[model samples]
Target: MKVAVLYEINKPLVIEEVTLPPLKYGQVLVKLKTSGLCHKQLEEMTGKRGHDPFLPHLLGHEGAGIVKDIGPGVSFVNKGDHVVLGWMKGKGINSEPPEYTNGRNKLNAGWITTFNEYGIYSENRVTSIKKEMPFDVACLLGCAVTTGYGVVNRIAKMESRKKVAVFGIGGIGLNVVQWASVRGATHVIAVDLRNDKLELARRIGATHVINAGNEHAVDAVRTITDGGADYVFEAAGNIHVMEQAYEATNGKGLTVLMGVPKKEDKLCIDPIPLYLGRRITGCHGGDTVKDEDIPLAVDLYLQGKLKLNELITERIHLSGINEAFQRMKEGKIVGRSIIEFERSSPD
Candidate 1:
């Protein structure tokens, strides 16, 4: 199978033929249909974040495909079922004793992301693919969409009539805007520097849009929501924007940091404001439980509450991934750039 291999940090991904190991217990083999490019992939590729930093590593995490083979003891899905890949591919966390809360187990600690094509980004992928929806859309449930939704629904505890502002109307941020709207936010403000993204945000459900380039984003958000929003989400991963998000919140409001920032970077905030009930929180993978959240996200997509199709801006072949990454860096694309793999015809 042909998979894009990351040989080193800040280097181009090399598409090469590689061998895939047979499926292990509790795993399945998927013939990938499409996978999305996430900012996390770029971060991992550039060594901005400490991940699988070694060379010759597969590097995709948002994937969806058809089930071609199944490993022993797995029965949740069957062969030929259309499914989306879960982000954490490793074993789920054991929900017992100190882990379980209110009669529910905690999320799993799986490592099955969609970065690898076969292993992470190959023509063939090895993992458990849960069958339910179209592979292309399902792939997004693995990461971008899930992350945004998880932040809003799970982390922030958003309620009706709250004023919400989502910074960075890109892939994950866009989802944040729509989810905020769907969850009954009275004033949903979408903030971005790009007009195209802001327009897309309104189309999805943002009641108001702010171009951070035109005015001070913090001021704009404060004016729109009348002194600040109830919840401010920092999804751009930019330190400056993150600080602005903190400042744009109402006194005692909550700010959720969803973007992955540089390890060494830091943001300065007024300690006094926090004492007045202001809360700042950081989350990982949107605090999602894949087994439960993935299905719920899928159902939302089917119900027209979640906008998945509109989030996909580009679809390219497996070989075109490098160019896709280049476009992403240039901010030439919005939402997600998905890679569609063509299956090899039988001889």
Candidate 2:
């Protein structure tokens, strides 16, 4: 199979032919149809996220594909089923409960993330896709969409008539805006440096848009929501934006940090506000329970209530993966950019 290999930090991924290992117990081999480019891939390429994985490792995280084969003991899905690559691989209902914890009981299951081609991104990756969806849409259900929806519905627990603010009007942020609006937020503020993105944010559901570059984001969000928003979500990984998100919330408002920040990056804030009942929480994979959420998102998409089509900005061939990353770095694309694969062999 042909996979895009990351040869070195700060270098372009090299596409190379490689042999895939046979599926193991409880694993399903999926013939990938589409994969989305995410900022984490960029961070991995530049070593911003820390040590690199194995040299020449396949690069891709968000993906969707068709099941080609199933290994022993796998019965969640069957061959020929269409599915999205899930990020939390090992941390599902089948996982084991943790033996020990600080105080509260917790599961020891490992998170399922799609970072490698077969692991997370590739023509054929390990997955258990449902039979009822398109590969392209299913792939997004793995990360971007799920993450955004998770922040709004799970972390913030947004309620009707509440004021909400979403910083960074990119893929995840746009979903946050739409979900908040759908939840009946009376005032939804979208903040971004780009006018084009702000426009898209409004079209999706933002009651107001703030150009973070032209005006102070914290002040702008405050102005829109009176004193402060009931909930604020920071989807941009930048530290400055994270601080702005914190400032945009009221004294007791909830701030959800959904973006993955660089390793070793520290956030500095006063102790007083934190003591004032304000809450800052972090979420992983949108706290998604795949068995529950993925199907719900799929149903929402099928109902036309969620705007999956509008989220997709472009579709490129698998060979165009590098170009897609370049465009993403240049901030020339919006929402999501997918790599659609064309089969080279029937087998």
Candidate 3:
């Protein structure tokens, strides 16, 4: 199979043909149809989240595909089953990570990887979805959509008519806006430096938007909320923006940190806010239970209650992966960038 290999940090991924090892127990072989590019992958590429111990490894965590085969002890899905592959664990065996080999060297891969024509995913990382779900949109269910909705519904437990602010209107942030609006938040304020993203956010239920590049984000959010929003979500993966998101929240409201910052970066905030009922917490893939959440998310999309197609701003092939990352870095993509795969023989 052809896969993108990250041989070193702060370098472009090398696309090469690799030989896949046999599927181990609880693993499933999948022919990927679509893969969603995420900021997390960019973080890993740039070493923004710190050391890269797993160099020369496969990249990507969110994808949709058809089950081509399953290894021993796997029961959650079957051959021909349409599934969403994610990083979050669901209800299956936690299999060992797969190893792939180029002609001369070994390459590493996690339980879930999608930046390839084919992938061997752990049972817990694959969730079977309806055959009718579009691969491009369904792939987003693997992380972006599930994580965004989870942050609002599961993590924050945001109530109706509450004020909400989301910093960074990328894929995850865009979902946060839509979900917050769905939850009946009176004010869904989207903040970002990119006007395109901010505009897309407004189209997808963001009641207002603030271009942080133009105006002060925290002050603008506070002003729009008539003080501070009841809930604030930071998805920019920047330490400074995280601080701003925290400061933009109401004294008694919650601040959910959805972005992963550099490993060495430390967040500084006033301790006095804690004493006054202000709460802050970090999110892990939106606290999503993939088995439960993926299906429900698909149902919502099928019912037209969710906006999946709108989140897709660009689509490209695996060969264009590096340029996709460049666009992400330049803030050129308004929402999600999907990597559509062509069917290939799993040699």
Candidate 4:
């Protein structure tokens, strides 16, 4: 199989052929069909999170694939079953990660790396999907869509007609806006630095859009919400924007943090807000129970309640992964960008 390996920080991934290791207990070998390009991977590659103990390793946390074979003790998924690969642990066995060597040195990988054409992942990282969903769209069920929808459904627990402000309208933030719209939020304010994103947010569900580059995001959100929003979600991994997102929340409202920050990153906030009833919480994978939630998200999409198809802004082959990351870094993509592995043959 061919996989993208990160040998150093701030370097293009090395796409090379590798031999798959023997599958261990509770592991499943998957032929990846598609994978999502996420900001978290970009952060890891650029050293934003700092330090690389796993220097030469495979990266990518979310994907869609078929179950090529099952190892000992694997049961939930069978060979030929369509599945979604995610970083979050779900039901089933959590197997040890696989090791891939290039005959000289060994390369490291997590239990759920999907940058490769094929992978041996822990059973818990693979969720079986029975619906006839496109591989590219299904790949998003692994992270981008799930995280956004999970943030609203599982964390924010938004009430109908509530005022909402979503900071940074990327894949995750855009989903927050979409779900808020479906949940009937009276005012869904989408804040971002890009006009393209703001416009898309408006089309998806944002009742109001603010380009942070042109005006004060907090002030604009406050104006739209009539003072402050009842719920605010920060998906942009910017400390300044995170602070502003908190500021845009009402005194009695809730603020959810969906962005992963650097190890040295810190939030500055006044203690008086907490004492006055304002609450803040951090979300990991939107606190989603992946095994259960992935199916629910699929059902919503099938029922015409969710817009999964519209979330993918572009699709490219594995060879174009670096350019895709560059587009994400420049904030040029309006939604999720996916890697269509099926477009190329295995090495």
Winner by TM-score: 4
Task: State TM-scores per candidate.
Answer: 0.84, 0.83, 0.91, 0.92
Off by over 4 Å in 4: 260-276, 344-347
lDDT for each residue of candidate 3 in 1-347, tens digit (9 for 90 to 100): 88999998888999999987898999999999999999889989999867888888999989999999999999889999999999898899999989899979889998888899999988999999998898989999988889888889999999999999999887788999999998999999999888888889988899999989999989898888988999999998899999999999998999999887878999989879989999999986778777888899899889988888988988888989999999999878778889988734211
Candidate 2 local distance difference test against the native: 0.71
Backbone clashes in model 2, listed as residue pairs: 32-123, 63-139, 87-112, 87-113, 88-112, 89-112, 114-120, 116-121, 117-121
Error at 101, model 2, angstroms: 40
2 or 4, which is superior by lDDT?
4
Ordered from best to worst TM-score, the candidate numbers read: 4, 3, 1, 2
lDDT of each: 0.73, 0.71, 0.90, 0.88
List residue ranges in candidate 3 displaced over 4 A. Answer: 261-276, 343-347
RMSD of 3: 3.0
Worst 10 residues of 2 by lDDT: 98-107
The collision pairs in model 3 are none
At residue 270, what lDDT does model 4 achieve?
Answer: 76
How much lDDT does candidate 4 score? 0.88
Model 1 stretches with alpha carbons more than 4 Å out: 50-53, 89-132, 343-347
Instruction: Indicate which candidate wins on lDDT.
Output: 3
